[model samples]
Target: MTSPDEPHDVSSGVSSGAPATGAHGLGPHVVGTRVVVRRLVPGETGPTGGPAFTDVLGVAETWWPDLVVRREDGTAVTVPHALIVSGKPVPPRASRLQHVPGGEVQRRVRGLWPGETAALGDWLLQVSPPHEGRVRRRASSVLAYGSPDRPLGEALAAIQDWYAARDRRPELCVAVGSAEETALRAEGWTEPADFAGHAVAVQVGSVARLRRALGASPHTAATGTVATEHGPVAGAAPDVERVRVSVTASGDRIATGLADLRGDWACVHDVRTDAAYRRTGLARRIVAGLLDEVAERGVTTVVLHVLTTNDPALALYAGLGFEEHHTATYLGPPR
Candidate 1:
């Protein structure tokens, strides 16, 4: 679900060429989403009549009343409204996870948290108690992979001991509905902690999309694209090293995008543009450059966490085909 402010662009219902629009109209939101349709009952032969299900999994492209659909196997079938009896969109497919049981993806995101981690069975204790003013929940939370492989009570005891040693408190940074969150609650560690709120989204598209968006960027000339590990970024820590990929369409480093690569996924950290470069499509070019640079490493999925209130960032990402996967909020341990 999108934030109250960020309404998704999916069609609510679709209208295809007659037969005629259904009483409720086929949900346009159904377009782009998978759906199953049952054509008018077999008043005739060959499964055409009598409430039969066309369990065909395909993306609805248009509902000109003639619902055009694209299938996974690169096949397209147009379902005319006349043939429709009933249909509805199904849940979106998840080939990625940054939510509950986000599993491997969540594990990979550990790189972005900037902390020392200790392997405690299947979990990792992020030891970022207090260094400077960065005392917060993320740096001092347990990343639960599977189960600890240790007893629950023992795990809690060990966590408390470790945090006590660091003069900090133990906390879990698991996805809201994840088993780990539930596990922590069962142990009587149920104080709801708040970290800067964030939500993760998934987008499935080819490098072609990236190339197109990049091409449209204001300073997207071939020279605009820059690929390097040490590219200059705005507001970056002077001593912090990053694998920066950016674009300089207006010269003098106007736009940049940075990523933290982990195995197959790249956590896009910052995609920025100079004030004068705003609305000029430089940011898109930067993202394109960033993704194109990382694609060489077989990075297929790009993930990012954005503040729920960042409306502009949310819109920019949505236009790039990203869809909400899940959200995570930091929850502190019991006092």
Candidate 2:
């Protein structure tokens, strides 16, 4: 995860203080970790007129007499130990659902509200008061994804202490079935009673596809003027990350959706329609308007965090060509 407090260090090279050759900064210790290795390609010549060198990115499967790497496509490549020139551990690849890594999306999402964020290695500890008369779990919870960069027990203790100082309950936003979730479970951490067994899927789709689907569906092409407003939201800076689109008919607002744009991606959330306007295709118009707005700003993809149990919402997004990329569960402190 990229910390809100600092940039991620993704430099790959020979491990610090290691030689330029032999073992190539790899050992039995790195066998199970993701890595990139630079090795000599036998019988090949380089542009420099020397022996060719190729870099392979994958998990280090073995480091005995020979080094074996398992690539993202699930193929294993073996390199002679004598052929290795340099290597180092690398971060895991992005999940299938991620157009950009989820951590990056979370970072941008956190920017929706002005707040203080501290880093526990790559994990982010968010600090803020409740907004709009509600305690947004994402605002109050620790983003316990990626690595803590410390012992699990130590990280957990720090998290609890950090929240305790603020007189707040400790909560964790962790990817479902992730190592962090498993470790937290083992340490007595569990979901809050209200959220037990519930998870939110982060679904993503292309802006072009969504706009096409919405435009092609006569049911969604409702007759209403869409008003787009861009400015501060939840008290963040003005004209930055916030956008709200609504459908108004006869001077009455009937449907609306919100989006927070960051770089090339935008997240749509809090969509709603008046009960009287339900099934009138106003919701689709609002969504389509939001998509069109973001697309004008050069955002190619849109994201939504929908509950796994939200059948209607899931069906709606599926119809728009969105696919589930990953899911997250909220874990509260151990009782």
CA RMSD of all predictions = 8.8, 16.6
Query: Mind giving the per-residue lDDT tens digits that candidate 2 earns over 1-335?
Result: 11111111111112334233464557655654578989889899999898999998876655655777766554668978788889898765554446667676666666665566789998999877665456667767798878997998899899889988887788888888888889889989888887765788777877875566455323233656678898655555454477898777788877778888866778787787777766565655667778888888888878777777665565455434466777888888778
lDDT of each: 0.56, 0.70
TM match of model 1 to true structure: 0.57
Off by over 4 Å in 2: 1-100, 216-223, 234-239
Question: After superposition, which runs of candidate 1 have C-alpha atoms over 4 Å from their true positions?
Answer: 1-101, 111-114, 128-140, 186-242, 247-254, 274-279
TM-score per prediction, in order, is 0.57, 0.66
lDDT of 2: 0.70
Global local distance difference test of model 1: 0.56
Poorest 10 consecutive residues by lDDT, candidate 1: 1-10
